[model samples]
Target: MPSNKAELAVRIAAAQPGDSVRGLFFKTVFSLIQQHAGPAALESVRVDALATNYSDLRTYPVQDFLTLMYRAADVLEATVGPENAVFHACGETGVTRYATGPGMLIFGIISRGDPQKLFAGAQMGYSAAVSYGSREYLSTGPKSGTLRVRRDMLPPAYHEGILTGALKVLGLKGTARAHAHDIDRVDYDIEWG
Candidate 1:
């Protein structure tokens, strides 16, 4: 039999990237958890909301992604628990904005045991091929972007926060400094357990 963490890792790793925006988001979240939390921690944690932007492509329209995300949230609420679940959507504008093309997908899973805790969160974006500023439209514009997303899931913010907080709760500390890239942003702080 696989260890608890290993089992969790398998469950997460087994998730396939569906043919929609949210599929990638779930895959990214699962991958990140596998990378950072290891098998044991994963087994200990329970995922509350597995929100996705797209649920059905055939019957559901593309613009209705937000609605579908809400539906997914409902599913999570019903499957997991109602009190601790959250579902969010972002478009090409405002705080939830992304690049011009296909926009991005953001989803998060709360910790069942600790409502305030976050097990994992993820954001993914895809840009279609397009032309820009007198330049010839390249067939390959922006493909996709993936990363672990969390609101205060880490140090300087612990269990009371999100995924990083859950990591802290599990005793995963940051030894390196913070850094930002044009494509991504990462923050790190020391941890002790």
Candidate 2:
């Protein structure tokens, strides 16, 4: 790995408590974008609103953000193969709450799965209520849904390296292209770097 990239990864790994993970992740991704895609590329990239449930209360410095991105990249690389890409924050933006148990934290990735397609699907979904009998219209809906299907195409190898760097920071093990499940969710494309 290049020195600058390695340093960034290491810094992210070294992040302590009270840091901003989301902010750092965004900056890191932007740095990678500037490095590979150039300043012009930044203009093309559009960050969606933080998911409704997402909160900024959680503090993650650069290191924490990098660690999370790295872990996510590891999962993607195992599924998609190495590629010249980077991970961006997707899904609900908020303090990720953990249950009082052992488990892995979940994150989402957004990419140009089918560059050939003209439109990318929305990342979230919801249901509306309809009246039954005596009650007026009331709806029960999901908070979110799968945004896109896994394209099964591998990204370039460098992309995987970025993810690997991030994972090393968190000291977490990642599986290649594992099928993570959510009710009524679509398959997300994953690859290993």
Q: State which candidate has the highest TM-score.
A: 2
Kindly report which residue stretches of model 2 are placed more than 4 angstroms away from their true locations once superposed.
1-21, 46-85, 88-163, 166-175, 183-193
Clashing residue pairs for model 1: 5-39, 5-40, 153-164, 153-165, 154-164, 154-165
lDDT of 1 by residue, 1-193 (tens): 1123332333233333331233333333333334444554333332333333322112222212223323333333333333122221111011121111122122122333321122122221111211100111111112211222222111111111233332333345322123223111233332322
lDDT of 2 at 89: 23
**CA shift of 97, model 2, Å:** 22
Error of 1 at 141 (Å): 38
Candidate number achieving the greatest lDDT relative to the actual structure: 2
* Candidate 2 global TM-score: 0.26
C-alpha lDDT score of every prediction, in listed order: 0.26, 0.28
Evaluated at residue 120, the lDDT of candidate 2 is: 26
